[model samples]
Target chain A: MDRILYGDNQFFAVNHISDAKSMEQSMKFKENDAIIATLDQAIEAGIDTFMCTTHDRIAFVCDAVRSNPEKYKDFKIYPCMPYAHKYANAVTELGIQGTIKQYVPGNFFGSMFKGGKALVSKDYLAIMELLVDAEMKMFEGVKTPVVFLQNVITDLLLGLGMDEILKGFHDYVREKYDVEPGFITMNLPKLAETLEGLGIENPIICASINSANFRMSGGKELYEETLRTKKIRVIAMQVLGGGAIPPKEALGYVCGLPNIESILFGASSKRNIDNTVSTIHEFDSK
Target chain B: MLRVALVGAGKMGLSHLSILGAHPNVEVVGVCDTSLIVMGALKKYTKFPCYKKFTKMLDQEKPDAVFVAVPTKLHYEMIKELLDRKIHVFAEKPFCLNPEQGSELARLAEEHNLVNQVGYHNKFIGTFKEVKRIIESGALGEIYHFTGEAYGPVVTKKKDSTWRSNPADGGGCLMDYASHVIDLLNHLISPVASAEGTLLKSIYSQHVDDAVYSLLKLESGETGVLSVNWSDDTYRKMSTSVSITGTEGKIISDASELKVFVKKEGALDGYTKGWNVKYVTQLTDQVDFYLRGEEYSAQIDYFVNAALKKGPNDINTFKSAARTDNAIALIKNNSKTKA
Candidate 1:
């Protein structure tokens, strides 16, 4: 189970619910580390998409990996590079591969870390413009994953036809540059199967792709098709299910999925990171 | 009020019937088509008398307005018969296979002072108003480029003889799909200063094209690209999206939804200071303008209104539809050379 973790208070939090903003700090501090620990604890777990909180934290994760390459050999790190200036050098220097989750909302913790330039909104028509500009500057010599963060499923619901959009963007970018950049979705209801069916063969960083609400319903054949489809790079989200379940139990549930590649964690403080590591250790022992 | 008789009791003929059926000022007493299947279907479906030959129908109905929804190759003969009868026409698109025929109908419409309209529904969609607003506002910065793309699953499932799929019947992607874009560009920009259009039969490899891509240069120094294709995969795709970037702001719409993104500046001096995103919902407005605040209906009401009011033709006239005819001509000409 090449499990990937996803929790992006530090990545691209939509601030969809009002309570999300209220619990912003504690959730960011606690749940975020739980994600990392979940990764470290599970023998099957790996890190596919990581949103670096600070330069120091990113360096710390890099250092931790560099120090114990064998210990984390199966783990592939994909650090978030949201901006062209600040994180660009850090990500390029550290040689992190994955997405540059462009946080649209200003209030998200990682938004400021986006270095004041790259935070783009869904309303902006010229999204490709920013991507092209970023590629020209920081990504000139780099060949790494650059994923876009789409916060809400509302636009996906309303007009954009989220599955079609994911496919279209993938097709457009791949055709233009022959590069495989990606986008991430979290907790979108009634879309897991559709998202899974779309022919996107890229890495998806999520928490709970197989939750009860967004479960793989229909017959066994349909369920298997949903699990094995090509376009869907399932990044299971809400693994902790809003911190309701024990982190270890959540890790086990996510790791059971045969197709899941990574789970994202939002670690705000060092204690959170340590807790995440402990959780991962516990998962590994299990 | 202009007495209208709609020929070809098919999908398009029924659409016109519904509109004329509702308009109190317009009387649609006659309908004609070769398809007894459709005619029989319409006997119960419509309240109009159906006939086979248009000449006998024309003689009997003596309609002042006739809408031709027959096959493409037959459009010229049917429209010419109506023009000879001094009847105003509302012809379905591909005004007639090539520009020469389109030019002929346009001249006749002009000569008879008849209000002729063609079926190009996108021009009547609600988003064009927003497009026009954005263009006039000069918000999208210096408008250097505009592109429109419309596509759907290629109708490979259809039999080989579907008029929409046969070159003799004006079947192909360029004439069927890209023609909308060409007419729209001509409507929005200046009459397409110069254009280079290409049609590809790569995806389906049938006698007809599965895709068409056209590059155009407008007189305004703006370059435009239009894509028309039958995207044959699992997903069905049909869209007409427009993007215009000007000196100050941008206007982009898929017609399904219209949005204009503008750049705002400094607040009141010593009073306020901030910037904000402005969301302009222009789709509803466009619908109101296009349908004259009535529900989205056929262009015949407007045409009849224009005729009765002796006003401008709200529907696409033979002149406007001729642009598509010209573009189709270019695509066919290019396809032959490439072959």
Candidate 2:
């Protein structure tokens, strides 16, 4: 994992801190070319991995990366799966049956699985595979070395105690895509314990890690304790506490922590990207 | 542990189940749904008992509280059954097909001295809660006009048959999407006393309107515009927000963030005049189990805690949500008359 990873929240108008800033980002990155230009700047700023959600626009990004293979040779994308809206919108337009038929295909539609509830764990695993395939369709030719399960599903599975589904994702991604399966969640301590329980060792987990507890469930102390003790590759995001912390203070606190393999952040500008990269470098050097 | 049973194991049902399943004070005893396959999976996966019928699940489990996440139409009967059983209940939003049903359910719950709530999850959003606190604090004095909006890509295409395509099933931008915004306006600003100049436009779904626009008059003489559309594909997900203007300041807020511009800097704590902004992460208190957002679990937490109380419920209770339902009916009637 790269010590520094760039993110796509800014491209999609997802500023956890400010709506005004989000709108500004939306206007600035309204075009696919604009998005590509920002990525180029991230590359110049020395960020090789782009951690992004599978928003429909990410397809255009994938196409752009594919067309200019030489320019993006060293670049990689960490795809967060289920792109929930894809299924949400589909279910909105076509309901459950139609969504499964359109997305799941094959046995899911043809078998005695007409009743959505009738489909058992076997079908669920198949559906998970198919949906993962569908979500990964956007990254066809790009290099996605680590695929992530979005926190929504990760936390849901965690809450439901669906350990097998978590492992199912781990196994499917490792076996099928030949990539490491990562899980992003708000509750790092709980997930760490759960993964430990599942016998899934040293998992890759990206969560909110900052001086403030922020989105980290349990609390900041627990996250720090987990980081110190857990066997996991931790990609720290929301280190700024949704911009609550100053850049220097945020980076300083996170950089001082152990086992933080990468720090993920999103920026829609060259200046901000460069500043963030330089700040992280300064803290790491210290 | 508070014994809890769930009805309607659809998306929202399952979501609530997961969070409640993990709640420290809660034990999910049974889950009921019409979907055999959903039941089959629940039986196979989780330790909770699964049933196809709601009555049987409630009768067998004898839960202290029942979470009814069924469609809007099913809300009335199922919730009434729970209230009749003297069980504290939580139902999903856009409470019922009409205000009449909502009021009846509210009356039943009140008469039985039960804690009841509707899942207007936005009320638990810290940013929006801050908006309410700011407005009520008179930081934004003499609030005049506002606009409530929600636009998403839910019904971008013309559909064959779905819950979203049927008005009876609480399909439509107004019911499914706009209700969240309407409820926010009701709770944050004022209960909409009436509505006028309504325009329910169908951009995609033939059976139901995909967009709802209208002028709403709140009980406190505050006025606002309701603009909602589910056919807008620009947003990756449902985006709901409110922009309220007052003589002293103006506040614009969504699920993720809140922005306020005030004439005086010292008007509110943690907020400077001129301009101040806050995020969900900063404002929201952390929950033990967070699903999509803390608001989802927080809403359920509120309901579950309120369930243990003896008297009437508070915070998105049946009575409070009935106001939103009444507002929805006003908008619907106004739109129909003009159309």
Candidate 3:
């Protein structure tokens, strides 16, 4: 993960605080051009890493990057898998089989047989691999050094005690795609403990770490303690608590934390991107 | 005896379970479902070990064959792993959601030399089997046109919440109902070479089609029409019928009976063919135990026996199912372009 990774919440209508803002953002980014322009703005401001979900439209963004490889040579993407809404909508539109056909790359019949056999044999890890492949399909030939499991599935698997799958994903990504695997979760402390128990030392975890503790699960104190002690690379997200906290104060609070390797934020305009980047630089210098 | 297990405890899963469990040559090893409620219900019918996680079941039971009736979305990966494990699989139709997946699975099954079958139970229906026999015999010489109709009351109202109403889950009348018609058409006539004049209408579901109509041209040069509506509430129950017209005669067949008419004698077996009706009861095989439809059991039995190398591996193989998938892809593409 980069020191300042651009987030995709603004590209998709994902607002933790307001439905109105989410709807507004959804309308604004309805066109791929708008998303591309914003991404270009982020790149112009020296933010090279674009951490994003595998939304259907992200395929267009991946194409944009691939088309002008020279311009985005230093750029990178951290793809998150099982974009729940995408799969849900695809299921509603294409049906499961059709959804797999549309999303999963490779020969259709071969993939279908693969999918069918995985399901029958209860080889869910293989299914997860298929999904990961499906999500990463668009990023072929693009620079993607890290792949993150979205918190939606990460937390669900956590709750389900599916540690094997979590570890399996890490191993698969490293062995097959040759990328570092990252996990986003609401409960950082528990995740750290879980990863360490699985012998995954110094795991990279992205979670909410802020002054107000707005969306930070297990409270701010616990996250602080884990950051101070755990052998993990922490990526601070939602530092502004969905814009409840001021930017400078939020950046100051998170930047002052120990072992904070990255800060991920989303902004729709160049001005916001510029200000956030400058603020982080100022804090880093101090 | 062949050891078998089942994943998915839904309607189809239970159907497969009942037949597999009762079969004389099968030993039901395990049943797995994500839902405890579903697995709990399954426990009443069989004392086999139940599991919420499929991998656990597979690891513990290690069955020689597995029957999968999970959502269509889950077919590809599941089928792939089963093939890798060398476990013969009997999957529910449509074999896959798309042509690519269907073809891939077909290829893998052939490569692995595995006995793979899709749940196109209509093929096993007595009337349908007789219809296929008549067509293969060329009783209806120079077949020129055919029509297929399937109607039911599965989605008469808004069904936005269920997987069947969702396209990703392989929901909608087109994939669910029209697929059967397409398979039957492929069996009786020939693989659909081109499909046109498609109408995919949604009466109750916003995502998937509730009614589907299409014009098809088979590779055998036979023209056909398919009309299927899951939203139609007037039908007393689900009804699917096919009528084929040829140079010498015509035949109309449904689940219950097959009616044939011939202009010349000796056109079909044991029939002068002025107008003859053969009820399903008269044509069906005598079975010791049955549920839902004998065709369902027949398909399962065929797969198991095929897996045991006692029968020919010719029961709706993935290759055959891929043809239906191709027809579906064509219909869907045509409908989208027109829309």
Candidate 4:
């Protein structure tokens, strides 16, 4: 058995490494030995997943995998990249590998570095081609297949010509780049319609974990509808909203959702890790 | 007296042509575009003299003003060339790829002392202006925090490889959509101190952010969340809304609807008031601001007067445009964009 990805007993914090300084702090808890010590500790405590929210956290989390390479040969790490950063296989291989996807190119409106500018044009098709090409190049030379995590916002899409534009880009990728990237739908209803329109059959999970409870209520029903028509997968994120809510509440929320394969979580301190493992254990016992 | 020519017949150009074509004071001298197909269609549709090249059109027509409605990549060169000709200009939103270009445009316009404007039509929306009025009036009382939401269906093209997705060409949902929200935030809350957010979608391309959620902190200790995206299926739910929670009351405004929710004291408990929508069209601000004398003149009389008299009726400037550019920079700086 794959062991339930989420249960009443297992829970974790959704944390991102703030800076390089925090890396030192992370080492102390896991005992300056290897990165997986922490993962091992959490796993011993019954927690199954650890979500590193930023690229900065990847190295610290990956130290375990790098040190013991084979120990975690079976484990999966989900390191959150703001966007294109995850494409850097050098750093990403150490931790986890999930395609980090974002909309805005470069930093909002700053000057571009050489070979760093985005391919832009007035013709929407031209832009779509560039995006697909980049996706192809980014995913190149990767041992582990990546599932692009798309965190979409509802308000922004409608403000622009959403349907016509997204379809144009997606179609271009499918035709030109030959990649049908996976998306984590923040808005379930919209994602289903988008998938149906494109005739695409890939997994589409709920974005982040904070809204696990919200998705459980009606999102699961919507998830079912999409799955019935197409072949999209579903998952959850922000399970604890950065540890704001207690671990149990977060665990219960993800545990409650149907067909949820993964719930991404983050941790800042050892106590958080212990609490998360304990929460997972408690949920499992119940 | 103010000779003006247009270089495109697209929807926006047509809108401008309609207004300028019939104005009593302004002369609708010429229109140009490389697309003879679109030109012929437009001429048959709207009936205006069309040219293949703007330079040829400008040289033959000798208009005092020029409107560059071409693609984003073409903007810088065209505007610079026009400004070199000592002509005034008006461009559309996502002004340039970055703030530096916007500032350069502003500086060049100033160096030439030309009237420059950008089409941020949302700003002129009556509801937002009224909300601004209410905020300025101190009715909401001590503005605290705000959340602005602008979302709609995804945008694609008939053909592939269009400029909208190009990062260098002022493409992507962030520049195309969110910049409007950022501009509005700049207007409502001056000087964004810091901004941090994540781009959520790559549905369209790897280089662009289709969906983004950002937290902005103003220099005045006010915080706001601006969520802009091109990823939703509710096509008609296309709305721009602003919610402000103040010490005394709360004010909400979207597109053309503005409302205020206030706390009632002892005497006025349970009573609801001040939900006035101010029945006015959004375009009126631009119309009235630019064409004050005439009630319903298709042409902006002020643009003509400014051209003829060489005096002043130009309401927008480069500095104001630069502020928008800078705010967009702040947004990009704090973005978590790698893989």
Candidate 5:
């Protein structure tokens, strides 16, 4: 894992604080060129990894990075799967069969055949892998060292008591993509325990890790206890506690924690990005 | 532990089942769905009993409470049956396609003295919850104007026919999308008394409206605007927000954050004369089981606790949802009158 990973929530209209700011960011990154410029600023600030969701617009970002190999030679993208809202909207508008026809990869006739068979047998793992392959097509030939399961599906599976699907995703991604598999969740402690129970040890998990325990399901102590005794590498996210805690205090809390291998953050401005990097560096130096 | 069962294994149903299945105070006895595929998967994967028919499941499992997550067209029959059996019930939002059926069911629940709730999960969101609290504190004194808006990318392109394009299924921007905003308005501010200058526009659907625009008058004699569009591809997901202006201050909030601007220094406690911003992180409480968002699990836990304590049917009750349903009726009627 990189010491610092840039996120893509700001590129999309996802803001935890205000919708007005989100609309402003949506206009600011309306074109791929603007998003590439921001990525360049992150690279100039010494961050090398971009952890992003597999939204349709991200395909353009991947194209820009793949075409300019020299400029982004060492840049890596940590792709997160299923892009949630894509499937949600598709399912609502297109229904199940139509959604499969629209999103399942490979030849149309072949996907239809396999989709029907998968639906018949209720082979959820098969459908999951097909969707994973569909979502991963954009990242082809790009440097992707790690793939993450988005928290929507991760937390759903955790609550559903379907630990096998989590294991299935991990094994398939590792065997096919040959990259480390990661899971993002709101409840880090339960997911760590669930993974360990499935005989999978030392997994990579990213979650909200702040002193305020904002969106930290089950609270802060369980997460801290898990980090102290568990054998999992963590990527601390939402370190600013949904923009409530100040950056210095937020970074201080996260960087001082044990077992946190990296911090993931997204910012729309160069000044904010540079400030976060310096704050992390300052805390690390101590 | 309270014995619980769920009907309809669709998207929202599955989300509710996942949360309730892990709840400490609940024991999931049976799950009934029309899809044999979903039932078979649940029976194979989890320990809960699965059934094909709701009536059969009700007879065999005899649960103390039931969660009705079927389409709006099916809510009346399912919830009525549950209330008749003296079982507590929690039904999904836009409670029923017909407002009269919703009111009758609300009356039935009250007559039977059973715990009844309609799921309007936004009320449990911290930022929006804070919006209600601030308004109640008179922080925004003499509330004069408000706006409730929501947009999403649900119907960005034309596709084959589904339940969304069917009015009988309680589908469209008004029932499916705008109802959320209207419910929030009723909960946080005042219930809408009338609507005029209404426009229901169809962007991509042939049979249903994709956008809803209307001018609303609250029962308190104040007015506001209701603007909602589900065909907006600019937004990645559903973004619903509320803004209120008053004599002393103003407030703007979505599910994740809250913003307030006061005119005086001592207008509200902990709020300066200038703008004060608050995030959901500090305002939200922890949930035992989380999926999609904290609001989902929080609402379920609230219902469970309410049932356990035999508390008043005050929050998100069928009565409240029926109020929202009445507001939807007013909007539809206003559109017809204008046309």
Candidate 6:
């Protein structure tokens, strides 16, 4: 992961604080051109690594990046999987079978048989891999060095006592996709502990690391303790607490923390991106 | 009489409730939904108690079986809990969100020896069933290729905030409508061996897909194509059809009719073997209660009967639905790779 990775939350209508703003952003970025323009702006400011959800629209963005290779030649994407909402909407419309058929990789029969076998044999790891591959489909021919699981399925699986799937994900991404597997969770400390239990040393985990502790489960103190002691890579997100914390103050608080190798944030404008990037640089130098 | 409780009071749930209520061999113990407004409206029609919580309904009713028509995301946990309590389950399509949950539930059902069925009512449609029979009887000999299509006018515009449009809630045209077509393909043709050239496009809804297209290869040396669009307002109603081509004949089927074209005349089901057309009404099962089609009632009756061990417990097992899930997984994966 890059020291500063651009996120896709702004393009996908995700607002932690206001639904109205989220809706507005969704409408604004509904067009691929708008999204590309913003990405280009970020690139102009020297932030090239994009940590994005595997939303359907991102496929169009990937197309933009692939077609203009010179523009994004050094750019990279970190795809998050099971874009829960994508799967949910897909299942709602296409049904489970159709959803799987639509997203699962390989020829129809082989993938179906693999899916069927996974279903019958309870080989959820295979299903998880299928979903990961499906989500990564858009990033084909694009550079994806880090693939992470979204917090939706991450926390769900964590709560379900299905940490083995997490380990399986880590291994699958490493072996099959040849990318570092990252896990995003609301409970950073717990996820770290779970990953360690599976013998995943120094795992890459992304979570909320902010002064306000907005949406940070298990509190701030535990996260700091885990970061200091866990020997894992940390990507601090929601550093602004969904806009509750000011940019400079939030960056100062998080940049001062230990073991945070990277910072992930989403901004729709060049000013916000430049300001956030510069602020982090200023705080880091201090 | 087997006592049954219903979870989810939405469109499909209500449909199940209607048939379950009228069945003489079954008792509708209760209905449950998260919405008081929906439960209230449902309460007006039936004396069966309504509750907001499923656990309370289950504890109070102690129904022998549960019919789940909830969202796909809710299927795994709810069905797992019911199966844990040794309750038979007949859930609506898309069995579970993914194969893992489907497998777990299937294993639970098998371990409990409970009768389980997924609501692939298209399999119960007379013309489709006839299509299956014709193919199984070697009428469409040495089948080589098939195509399944489903079109409707569900999400032509911006959809309301419902589970049907929310991806987190497992709502999308690919899952909702295309699942039927995929299941039909699994039932009539051979199981999908591989799929390519797949696309899941969203025209109107931001989250859910409105259109899907796929090219598939079946395990039995056959090929398939699936094209579905839930946002197609040009169609008056939801139309699902399948066309199969083989060495001996071809069968084209829709909701109301099955058209067969054979290379030679052979006495199979009293057909001349050349361009034989059969209306769904002619092939449909005679039933006491009919709403939409007898397939709904037929599927329900089959589950209820199978639950009571009065007949073979083979409708559409979770394993079978899991096969559809498998095919879907392949199609989705193929589409993504190609994209």
Whose DockQ is greatest here? 2
lDDT of 3 by residue, B89-192 (tens): 88888778889998998899899999988998899987889998888888888998899999876776664766787798888888888999999999878998
Q: Rate the local accuracy (lDDT) of all candidates.
A: 0.54, 0.86, 0.81, 0.54, 0.88, 0.79
The local distance difference test score of model 5 is 0.88
lDDT of each residue in B113-184, candidate 5, tens digit only: 888888899999988988888899987889889999999888888754888788889999999999999999
Best by TM-score: 5
Which ranking of candidates, highest TM-score first?
A: 5, 2, 3, 6, 1, 4
Taking the tens digit of each residue's C-alpha lDDT, what string does model 2 give over A64-173? Answer: 88998898899899999877767766765665666777887456567565443366688788878998998898799899999999998898888877788899999999
> What local lDDT does model 3 show for residue A148?
93
| Deviation (Å) of B248 in candidate 5 | 2.3
Error of 2 at B237 (Å): 2.1
Evaluated at residue A189, the lDDT of candidate 1 is 26
Write the number of the candidate with greater TM-score, choosing between 3 and 4. Answer: 3
Error (Å) of candidate 1 at residue A28 is: 27
TM-scores, all candidates, are 0.50, 0.94, 0.55, 0.49, 0.95, 0.54
Interface RMSD of the candidates, in order = 24.0, 2.3, 22.2, 19.3, 2.5, 22.2
Model 4 residue A239 lDDT score: 69
lDDT of 1 by residue, A1-286 (tens): 2333434454222221112332354354344345445446433333444433222234445555566767755444433333322333222222111122332223332533345332233312234334444432332223334434343221122111224444555565556656554444332222444444564444453323333222121222343455565444655555554443456676666666556555555544455555665675566556
DockQ of each: 0.01, 0.57, 0.01, 0.01, 0.53, 0.01
Off by over 4 Å in 1: A1-286, B154-159, B197-199, B232-237, B264-282, B285-298, B335-339
Please give the range of 10 consecutive residues that has the lowest summed lDDT in model 2 chain B: B305-314
Q: What is the interface RMSD of candidate 2, in Å?
A: 2.3
| Candidate with more favorable, higher lDDT: 3 or 6 | 3
Error of 1 at B102 (Å): 0.5
